[model samples]
Target: MNNNIKRTLTTTILAAAFTVQAGENNFDQAYNSVSEADLRSHVKTLASDEFEGRQPTTIGEEKTLDYLTRQFTALGYQPGNNGSFLQPVELVRIEADPNVTLQIGDDSFEYKQNMVIGTSREQESVSLKDSELVFVGYGVNAPEYGWNDYAGVDVKGKTAVILVNDPGFANPDSGKFQGKTMTYYGRWTYKYEEASRQGAAGALIIHETAPASYGWSVVANSWSGPQYHLVTANGNKDRVAVEGWLSVEAAQTVFQKAGLDFEKLKEQAKNGPTAKAMSVKASVTVKSSLKRSKSNNFIATLPGSKAPDEHIIYTGHWDHLGKDPSKKGDNIYNGAHDNATGTASLISMAKAFASLKQRPARSVSFLIVTAEEQGLLGSKYYAEHPVYPLNKTVANLNLDAMNILGRTKDVAVVGFGKSELETYLTKAAKRQGRIITQEDRPEAGYYYRSDHFSFAKKGVPALYAEGGAESADEESAKYRKKMKVILNGCYHQVCDEYRDSWDFGGIIEDTQMFFEVGYDLANSDDWPKWNKTSEFQRPE
Candidate 1:
C-alpha cells in the first residue's frame, strides 16, 4: 500500500482498538450533563430583547453566531467549516410591493388580502403578465405512490394553480397516499418544487385553513415580509418565475369564473384517477424588487475517536421574525418556542457531548442555522454546500420549538416511519419510561416544517421528535387544549417570549434523549438508513 493508504488504515485500526478498550458507555455522564438550568440560561439569552429576535443578515445574526461560537468553543469543539465556525451563505431577499395584484380573468386577487405571491428566482425584476392558469389539483407527481395530479396536463409556460396538502388529507382513503398524514408531497415546498419540475411559469397553492393547518394570517405574515432564497449560479433559473398562495375564497372565485365548481373539483382531486386538469380561463400578473445579503450558518464540531470522517449532526435554526417596527407596543418576536428553545438545545447537547469521558466513534456537529422563519434557507444552503460529504453523514437530529409543556408519557416522532433513527429514539425514550408515538396532528406537516428536512431531502436519515400528548401530571384533554391555545396565540408572534410558567422539565428530557440517540449513532458501527419504501432513501 502507498504511504497515505497505510497511514489511513493504521489510524482506523488504532481507533477501533481504542473503542474496544473503552467498554463502559460514558453516555450517561454526557446525558446527565444536559441540564435544565443550562438550557433555560441559553434560551433566555438567545431570546432576550438584546438579541433583537436573532434574525438573519442583521446585528441580531452577528450576536447569535457569536454566542453560538463562544458556547461551542467553551465546550472544546473545533470549527466545523474548514477551521472556521461560520459557513457563508449567499442569499437574495425579495420584498414584493404590497400593491401588487393578480387579475384572474374578471376576478382580481389583491395582495395580502385575497392572495400572496413572490418569486424564488434572483433577478433585478420579475413579472408575469396574463399567464394562463390551470387547476392541477394537489400538484403532486409521486410515481412510488401511483399518484400524479399533473399527469394529463402540460403546465409548461403556464401558471399551475394547486391545492395545499396531499389529496388523502381532505378525503381519507387508507389505500392511497399515506392516509390523512401529510407526506413530503403535502408540503408547500414540494408543491413549488414539483411545479418548477413540470416547467410551470408560476405556481399558486390554494390555501384552506384546515388542510393548510395554519390560518390565512400566517400565509399573509410569512409571505409579506422580505422573502429570501439562496443565491443561484443561474440566478434560480430552474425555479418557477412566480410562486405564491391564494385564499380559499379567492380560489373559489376563480373556479366560479371558469364555470367549474370548486367544491366538486376538490372532491374529485381527492379520489384517485378521477382528478383531471382543467383550464381556469384565468390569468395572473406579478412583479417584485430584489435585495441581496449574506448570512452565516454557525457550525462547530466535536471530533470522534474512531471514525472522525463520519458524522452525526444536531441541527437547529437560529432565526426568527426579528423586530416589527409597525407594531406600537412590543414588536420583537423573541421566538422563544418557534426556535430559541431549539437553538439553545444545541448548546446543551454540545455541552453533554463535550463532557463525555471518551468521544464517540463518529464525529458530532452542531449546525446552528439562520433564516428558518424565512423558509428554512440557511439549512437548505448547508445541505447544498456541505462541509463534509453527505454520504458520510449518518443522521441529523433536529430540535424546534421544544417542549415547554413539561414531561410527557410519550415522545412524538415527526415523519416517524421514514428512518431507523425512530427506532433508536424509541429505545432511548423507553429507558426513560416513556413510549414513542407518531405526531398526533400529522395534518400540520411538522416533519417538513423544520431544518432536518433540508438534510432528509439529501438522503440523510433525520429525526424530529417532541413531547407527545398526555403530559405526565396533566389530563390529556386539558393538556392538548392549552397547547392549542399556545400554538394559536404565541406561535410566530411577539408573544413567543420566555415565560416563567414554561416548564423546562420536558425540554430537558427531550434534549437528553437527543443526546443519547446521537451518542448511539456516533459510537456504533451501524449506519442508519431511510426505510426501503421511503422517498428519502439513498439510491442503491
Candidate 2:
C-alpha cells in the first residue's frame, strides 16, 4: 500500500477508537498508582554510591538487574524476553592509552588537553603516521541536500580534520540543512561515519563550544575512559583507524601552521565548498586494551487481554558515567538527573500499568536498558535483535532525565512534530491543564542523544517528552533560573548525585502523564506514524 493510503486508514481507525470512552474511574486508579514516594525511593537506591555509578560489566550492573527483576516480579509482570527477563548484549570495551600525543607537522598536542583520540577497532595498536591532513568543510556528504564536502578529495589514507555541526549552523539564515535545528548530519558520530565511508585513515572534529553544545572538559572526561561498542564479527574494522576531537585552540594552531585562514574557510564551507588539503602531515598512535563482556537489558511485560502480540514499549536507561577513582574528594558520577530519575520513573510507571483492573488491548512492556551512557548500546542491541518483532511493536515512549524541579505549566517535547505519538501526549497534558512546547535548545539534539533514537532509526514511532521551562505556579522566572543553575552545574559531573532538596512533584506529574500516554497507545487498535516531512518513516 502507498504511504498516504496507509496513513489515511490509520487515521480513520484512530478516530473511531477515540469515540468510545473507557471507564474514567479505572484509569484514575492506574494514574494515581504512580507515587512520588516510590519514585524517590527508587532514585535514592539506584543513584546511591553503593551502586558504583551503575556501570555495565561491573557489580553495579548486577545490583541493578537484580533490583529491576525483583520489582517487576513483585508487580506481577512476566518476563518479556521469551521466558527470561534478561536479553544479553555482547559488547567490547576498548580503553585507549592517554599517554599519547597528536603531532601535526612541527606542532604537537597533548591528549585529553587539546585533543581526545580513540579507536573502536579491537586491536592492540593503531597508528596514523605521516598522514596528510585534509580540511573537509563540514565533512558531510549529504546528497539529499546537494552538499558534498568530499566531492573532489580522495582521503583514502589521509586524516580528515572536519568542522563540528553542519553548514546550516554557521549560516542559519541560508535555509540549508534544517537551519540551526541540527539534523543527524551535524552530529560528531555522523562526521566520523562519513569520513570512514570516504575511506579516511583518521578523522578529527574541530570543536567549538557553541556548535558542540558542551565544553572541552566534557570531551576530555567522556572520551578518556574505556569506550564500549557492540561486538561485531570484524571488531568494527570498517571504522576509521583513529577518531577524535580537536579543541578550537589546537585547531587554530594547525590552521596557522598550514598557512590557511580558518575563519575564511568556515565561511566558504557554509556555501557548500569542497574539501581543502591543509598541506600538513599528521601522526598519532592509539594503543588500546580490550575486554569482551556481556550486559543485560531487563524486560518485563503485562500481556493484554485482547491483542497480546501488538506491544507498547517503555524504555529507560539504567547506566551512568560510572566512578572515576582518580579524582580527589568525591569521584562517583551518580547520575541522578542524567538517568537514575528516568530509571525510577520506569519502575513507577510499571506499577501504574499493573494496577489497571482491566488490562489494555495491546501488551505493555518495560525495557530498562544498560550502557546508554556508552552511546545507547543496550537499546541499539534490542532494536536490532528485538524479542518482539519491530513491526508488531506499536510505539516507544522513552523516559530520560525526569523533572525534579517542581510542577511545570508545560511539557517540552523533544524532536517535536516527528510522530503522531505527540497527539496522545497533547491530550494527556491537557488533562493536567498543561500545554506541549518545543525544547528550548533544539540544536543540542537531545532527541538523537537518548535511547528512543535507537528505535526511531529502525522506523519505530518514538516519543520523548519532559517538563518545560514554564512554572505551574507563581515562580516562573525564578524557577527557570534555578533549574538552569542546577542542570548546568551537575551535568555529567560528580555533583549529579541525588539531593534531599529536590521537589518530586514535577516528576510525579510527568510520570502520570507518561502512564496515560502509554495506556492510550496500548488500548488503541490504530498504529501511530511518522509525519510526512520527518526523516524517519515506517518501512513499506
Candidate 3:
C-alpha cells in the first residue's frame, strides 16, 4: 500500500465519521423538539383537578381517552387497534364493604384499621368463613431456585398468611434467590397467584414499611378503593376468595395470638432454604360488591415504512387515584408525578416521531392504558388480546412517572440486565453523556408493578428507564436526599400533584434518550431478546 493512498483512505473515513456525528446533531433537533413547555402543559392539564384523578370507569376515563385520541390524531399517527384508537377492555370493579374482619385465634382485627381484605372473584357477594390460616413463609414455590415456602403445609381451602417481598430480600447472599433484587416470587401479584394455584381460599400479606416499600397509608389508599380487574372468560375461578394486606400491628397481634414470635418467624423466613409453613389459628370473612364496566385503552401507531408487521411498543398508564372527597381541604389525588408526566411524554414522543423526515422500518405504537393505579389491567388485556402478535412485537419501552428533578449523569434501567434492550439503552444514554444503571430500590419489585410486565409476561422484551441518582448539578447530595423524600412521602399521595419546584430539564433529557432508544430500535432489523436466564423469557 502506498503512503498517499493510505492517507487518502484514512481522511475519507474520518470525514464520514464527522458527517455521521453531524447527522446525529440533526436527530438531536428532533429529539429536542420535545419541549419542556409541552411536557408541562400536557401534565398540568391531565393532572389537573378537573380530571378527577383520572380513574377508569368514571368521568376521568372519558376525559383521558378523549385527550389521548385527539393528541394522537393531531400527530398524524394511525389508530393502532385495527382502525380504531380505542381498545375496549371489559373490567370488573369490586369494592369490599367496610364490614370486613379477620380473626386469628382469640385476636380480632378490624377492617381498614388493622387489616383490609378484597376478592378477585366477579361476584356481587363473596366470603370465606371459618377458613383456616397457615403461615406460608414467603408463599413462593420456585422450582428453579429449589425453594418452596408452602412445601410441607397444605393451604387448600385455608387462608395463606404470606410475607411481603421475598426471603432473598432480607438475606444478603446474592446466590440465594437473586439476593436483594426482587424477582417474580417477590411480587405481591405473584404471591396471590401462587396462593390461588394452591387452592387457598384467601391470602393475606404482612406489610412492613421497609420491605413493602410503602407505608400502611399507601396500602390502605391503594387497596381500599374499587379494585379493577379484567373480566376473564373463566371469571377468575382459580383466584382465592380473598386477597389483602395486614398492617404490621395486625400481623403482630395475629402472631401473638397464634403463640408465635413475629420477629423470630421473620428471621426464619429470611434464612431461606430452612423456613417452613405451619397452620395458624385464624379465619376471615371477605365481602365485596362487583360492578362491571368498560375502559378504553388508547392506542395509536406510526406504521413502519418497511416492516409494517413488526412493532415497538411505548406504554404509559393514564389512571390515578380518583378524588377522595372525604378529605378536608385537597381531596383529589392528582397523580402528576406518579404518571401524568409519563402519559404526557407519550404524546410528546408520538409527536416527535411523526415529525421525523422518514418513518422507521419497524412500526412504533403508543399505548396510553387505563387502571394502572388499580392494577395493570389495561395492558394485561392488551397482552392477552394484542393488536400485534407477541412474537412479532419487537420490544416495549414503558414510561411511568418520569423524574422531574432535572437531568442527571445517569439513567436507571429498572430490572436492568434482564434483556438486550439495555444494550440499546446504554448506547443511547452514552450518546447523551449519561451512564446506565439499575433501579436503586430493586427490592420494591417496581418492575412487576407497571404495565410493561404485561408485555414481558407474553415473552416480549421490555425496557423501563428512569432518571438515576447522579444529579448533574452541585445539588447532587440535596437531589439524592430529595429523591428519597419524594418516594417516601409524596409518591402515590395527594402531594404528588404538579409542583413549580420541578426542573423539567432532566425530564426532557430522559425523554429524548428514550425517544432515541426507540428510534434506533425501530430503524434496525434486530429483534431484542430477553437474556437467557431472564425469568420472563418463557413464552406464554
Candidate 4:
C-alpha cells in the first residue's frame, strides 16, 4: 500500500482496537460525571421568563440561539456550518383565519372542535371551489406491502379523506397490518402527502383522541397558533391544495349523512385495502388566510482526527410556544419537558464529547434544530440541505424531551426494533448496569412524531432516546400505571413546565447513555443499518 493508503488503514485498525477497549470504559462513571445541577441550570435559564419560551422569529429566537452558540463554543466544539453555528432555515409561517369555514353541500365543519385548517401558500385568501371528496382508506400507497388505498381512483382536484392510525387494526386477526404497531400510514403528514401525490385539492384526516393517542386539544393547541413550513419554490406547490383534520364525531356525522358507515370504514381502512376510495359523490369548499416568516437552526461540531468527511450527529430543537400572555398564571409555554430539557442535555452532551482524551475517527455534529414544535421544520431543512452527505453520516442521535422522574434503572427507545442502533444502545445501557425498554405504546405512533422521523425518512438510521418506563425503586405495576397516566395528562399542556423537586437523576442517566451511543458510533467504522422489517430501509 502507498504511504497515505497504509496510514488510513492503520488509523482504521487502531480505531477498531481502541473502540473495543472504549466499549468497556466505566459508563456509570461517565453517567455520574454529567452534572444534573448544571443541566437544570441551563434548562431553567432557557425555560425562564427571560427567554420568553424561545419561540422562533422573535427576540426569543435570538436569545435561544445565542445561549446555545455560547454553550457549544464553551464546550470546545468547532462551528458546524462553514465556521458558523447557526443555519438559517427559511420558513413561511401561516396563521389560520379565525373566521375560517369549510362547507360541503350546506354543511359547515366546526373549527377547533371539528378540524384545524391553514395554508402554506402565499395568498391573502385560499379557497377550494367545487372539489369532490373521497375516502382513501388509510391514505397509504406503500408498494412493498402490496397495498394501495388509492387503487382505481382519479383523485386529482378531489379531496381524499383518510382514516387515522395503521391498517393492522383494520383487520385485527387477518395479519395484514401491523396489528398494533402504528405504521407510517397512520401519520397525518402521510395522508396529506399521499393526497398530494394523487393530485388531490385537499386532504382531511379523521382524528380521535384514542387512536391519535392524544386529545383533540393537543391538535387544537398546536394548530391554533402559528404553523411553519420549509420555504420552497412553487410555494411547496407539490403539497396538497390544503390539509386539515376532522374530529371523530364530526367525521361520523358527515359519513352518516353521506350514507357511509364511519365505524365500518374505519375498521375496513385498518385492514388491507378498502378496494374503492370514499366516493366524493359530494362537493366541499374552504377559505383561509396565510402568513410568511423566518426561523433559524443552531449547529456546532466536535471535529474528528482522521475522517472529517464522515459524520455522526446529535440533534435537538430550540423553539417552543413562546409567550402566550393571553393565558392566566403562566402565559408562557416554557416547554420545559417538551424540548428545553432536550436542548439543554444536548449542550451537556457536546461538552462531554469535547472533553474526551481522544478525538473521534468521524466528525461529531451537534445540532440544535428549530421549529420542531411546529412540525420538525428545521431538521427537515438540514436533512434536505445537510452540511455533510447523509450516506457518509453514520447515525443521528435525536433528543426532544427527557423524562425528569429522577433516574430509572432502564432506558426507553421509541422505535427499538426498527434498526441496529438498538444493539449499541443495549450495550451502552448494560455497561451502565441499566437496561433498555422498548416503546411502551408502539401502537400510538410515538416513533414518527419527533424530528428524527425526518432523518429516518431520508434512509439515515436515527434513534429517539428517552427515559425508561420503569421507575427506580417503584414496583412494575405502579410504574406502568403512573407512566401511562402522566404521559396522557401532561403530553402537550400548560402543565409541562420545570419542577423544582424533579429528580434529574434519570435525565443524567439518559444523557450519558446518549453520549456513548454517539461516541461509539463516532469512534467506529461500522454504520448501523435499518432492520429488515423497517419500511424506510432501502432495498439492496
Candidate 5:
C-alpha cells in the first residue's frame, strides 16, 4: 500500500479502538445529568413574556446573554472566546417603509400582500426605476450542472425575476438536481446571491406554496419586520439594490401584463435555463431606517485532557422574532418550539459533559448564537470570523427546534447521507432502541436553514438530527398527525408559545443520543468525513 493510504488506515483503526474503549467506560452519570425538569425550566424562562421573545439588540438579548453566562459559569466551563464568553458580532438592522409598492408596467403590487421587498445595503434608501425585467429561471448559474440562466442576457441594470426552489423539485423522479431533495442552489438566499453576482439591480422570487415549502403567511410575517445582516465595509453594495418576493397570483398578473404565459414558462424553466426579457419595466423604492448594533455569540468550553486544540462544537441560536406591538391580542412570538427548546438543550448538554468522571481527550464548546430569525446573521458572522481555527474544529452538532411531542422509535437526520457522522449517530441511537431515519420533508432545505450550516459551509462536518415521525407507542399515526399540525401552524407565528402539556420524552431521548455522539468524538481521534456525493468538501 502507498504510504498515505497506510497512514490513513492506521489512524482510522486507532480511532475506532479509542471509540470502543471510551464506549466501555461508565457514562451513566453524565448521560443522566440532562433532566426533563431542568430543560423545562430553562425553556419556560427563556420563552416567557418577560424575555420579550429574545430578539437581538433589544433588552431581550441582554437578559438572554446574562442567563446563559451564569448557567455556563455554574457548570464550570471557561469562556471559549479569549477569556470572554461573548464574541461581538457587528450587525446592521434595516426596517423598510411599509407603504412601498412594486410597479410592473401598469400593475402595482402592494407590500406584504402581493409583494414584500427590502435591501441588505447599509443605506437609508435604495431605488430601482424603470429597469428592464428579465425572467431568469431559478436564477441559477451552476456550471457543474450545465445550467446558466444568464448566459446571453445582460441583466446588469435590470430586475431579474426568478422562481423559488430548484429544477428537480417539480419532477422529483426525473433524476435532475438531486431529485426532489432541495440543494443549496434552490434556497432563496442563493437566488438573491446569484442575481447579485449577475449584476442585477433587483431580484424578485415568485413564491409557490409547494415549491417554497411554507405558505405566504410565513413569507409576509418574516419579511415585513426588521431585517439584519452582518456589517460590511462596502455596505453590501455588491448585492442587488432590492430583494423581494411575489405571490403566485401577483407573478401571474405581471407575466400576463407582459404578454407571456407564466405556467408555460415555469415548465420550460424546469427543463433548462429560460432567460427571457419581458416587455414590462420594474420600479420600486425602499426607504429604510438603519440601526447599527453589536450582538453576542456566547461561547463556553470544557477543556480537553489530551488534545485541547481539537474541538467538538454544540450550537443553538438564542434569538427569536421579538414582540410586535402592531398586533392586538398577543404580540410576543415566544418561540418555544422554534428555538427556546434548542437554546435550553445547550445548557442541558453542557451540564451532562461537565458531570463526566473523566474529561474527554478533545474539547467541547457550547455556542449560543443570536439573530437566527433574521436569516442566521450571528452564525454567518462567526463562520467568517471563527473563534477557533476551522481546521482544528472537529464537527458541529446543531440543536434547533427540538421535538415537544412524545418519544419516537426513530430519529430524523436532516440532510441525511451527507456525512460519516451518521455512522456514529446510528451506533449511539441503536443502543437507545431507536433507528436513524431521513427527514420527512427533504425539500424544505432544513439543513441550510440552521446554525450548523455555518460550519458546514466551512467544510467541517455537521449533524442536525431530531425526533422522528414514528412514535414509540401504539398511536404512531395519531402522533404524526398531531406533530404535523403543530409544525405547520405555529412556525414563525405568535402561537409558538410554551405549552404546559408538551411531552419531553422525545427531547430527552434525542438529547441523550446527542450526548453519546459528542462524547465519542471528544474521546477519540476520529475525523468524520463528508460523503463523496456531498457538494461540500474539506478545503485542501
Candidate 6:
C-alpha cells in the first residue's frame, strides 16, 4: 500500500476499533455533540439558591417549569402532551395544623416536636372527627400472599396503625416479602393506600430511621410546606382521607399504652402469622383545613418516523427539598444531584435526539414532573392520564439521584433486570467499562420510590440508573464511606447544594450511556419483555 493510503486506512481502522470497544472514553467525540456543561449549568441554575428549592405549587414551581419549557422549545422538541408544554397537575395543598395536637387519654403531644398529620382530601377542612382508633399490626392486606392485617378487625371508620416496610425486610432470612429488598409493602404510601381503600378515617405509619431508611425529620421537613397532589374532578377514592407519618418515640409511647410489644410483635409478624391489626382501642380526632391548587408537568417529545404511536420516555421530577425558613445553615435544599441533574440530563438527551439525522423508529418523550418529594404524585397523575397509551409506550428511563462522587468504574442501575430495558443498559455500560449493578438493597424498594414506578405499574418497562456509588480516584474504602455519608447526610437535606469540587466526569458518562440505551431502544424494532417472575410482567 502507498504511504498516504496506508496512513488513512490505519486511522479509519483505529476509529472503528474505538467505536466497537471503548466509546465510554470517546465521550468527547461520542457526545462531541452533547454539551453536558450546558446541561449542568441549567440544572445548577434551576437548583440554585434563588429557586426557593423548587417546591411544588409555589413560585419555585413557576420558575423551574418555565425554564424547562423554554429549553425544550429551543431544542425543537414538540410539546409532549396535546401541544402544551405545561400539563396542569391539580393538587390539594394541605399543611398540618401548626398547633396540631395528638392525644391518648391524658397524654397529649405537640406537633412537629411529637407528631405531624395531613391528608390528600379536598375538603376545605377535615378532622379525624372523633374517629375510633385501631392498632393494625403492619396494617397490610396482601391478598396475593394470603395475608391480611385487618383479617378480623373492623376499622371501617377508624384509624389503623401500621409498621413501615414489609415482613421479611427486618430479618433478611424470613423471605415472606422481598427480603430486605423493599417490596411495595415497605413503602409508607402503600400503607396509606390500603388504609384509604378500607375506608379508614385515618392511618399512621410508625417510623424508624433504620427500617424506613430515612429520618422522621424527613417527615417534618417534607410536610411542613405547601403540598401538591393530583386533583381529580371527582374526588372520592382519588383522595387519601388522612395520611401522615409518626415519630418513633411517639409510636413507642402509643404502643406502650396498649401493653403490646410493638418491636417484638413486629418481629413475630415476619413469618408466624399474617400481619394483623393490634386494636389500640383508642380514637383520633384531628381538625385541619385544606387548600386546593394546581401545578404543571413539563413535557417535550420527538416523534417517531416508523412507530409514531410507540414511545420511550425519559423523566425526572423538577421539584426539590425546598428551603425551610426555620432551618439553620443553608436553607435551600437545592437538589442538584437529587434530581436537577436528572432533569438536566433529560434535556441534553432530547437535544441529542433532535440533532440526529435519522429519527428513531419509536417516539421519545422527555417529561419533567412536579411534586416527586410529595410521593411521586405528578408521575402517578401522568400514568393515570397518559398522553400516549401505555401499551404502545415501550419503556421509561428515570433519573432521580445521580452520583457526583467523582468518576467511577461502574454505573449502578435500580430495577435493573425486571424488564428488557436492562439489555439496552448492558450495551451502554459495556462501553463505559462498567456493568449495571442491581440495587444493593432491593428491600429498600428504590424501584418503587421514583416516577419510573408510575410507568412500571402500567406494564411499560422502565430503567432508573444512577452513577456509581464507588469512586475510582479514591480508595475503595473511601468510596464505600462516601456512599454511607450520602445516605445519611445531604440526601434530601438543605446541605445538598451544588459544589464546584464535584466531578462531572461520571455524570457526563452516565448521561451519555443513558442516551445510548434509550437511543438503541428508540431506533430498534425490539419490543422488550419482562422476565416471567417479574411482578411488573404483562399478562398473557
The C-alpha TM-scores of every prediction are 0.91, 0.96, 0.93, 0.89, 0.95, 0.89
Ranking by lDDT: 5, 2, 3, 1, 4, 6
Shift in Å, residue 441, candidate 4: 1.1
Per-residue lDDT, model 3, residue 293, is: 93
Residues 371-392, candidate 4, lDDT per residue (tens digit)?
8887788889999999888888
Q: Candidate 5 on 1-540: residue-level lDDT in tens?
A: 863455446546644675676666657877888899999999999999999998899999999999999999999999989999999999999999998999999989999998999999998999999999999989998899888888999999899999999998987887778877899889999999999999999999999999899999889989887888989999999999999999999999999999999999999999988899998999989999999999999999999999999999999999999988888999998999889999888899899999887898999999889988888888888899999899999999999999887888889999988987887787678768888889999998999899999889989999999999888987655665676677667889998988876778888888888998899899878898898888877898
Compared with the true structure, all predictions reach lDDT values of 0.83, 0.89, 0.83, 0.76, 0.89, 0.74
lDDT of 6 by residue, 224-301 (tens): 665655666675444446666778888788778767677787777666433444445433444545667888888889
Q: Candidate 6: global Cα-lDDT?
A: 0.74
The residue pairs found clashing in candidate 5 are none
Evaluate model 6: give its TM-score: 0.89
Clashing pairs for model 1 are: none
Q: In model 1, which regions exceed 4 Å deviation?
A: 1-26, 273-285, 475-487
Candidate 1 per-residue lDDT over residues 212-313, each given as its tens digit: 888888888778867888887798889998899999999888887777899888888888633444555445445567878999998999998999999998
- Clash counts per candidate, in order, are 0, 0, 2, 9, 0, 14
Q: Per-candidate RMSD vs. true structure?
A: 6.3, 2.9, 4.9, 5.4, 3.2, 6.6
TM-score for candidate 4, please give it: 0.89
- The clash number for model 5 is 0
For residue 153, what is the lDDT in candidate 1? Answer: 77
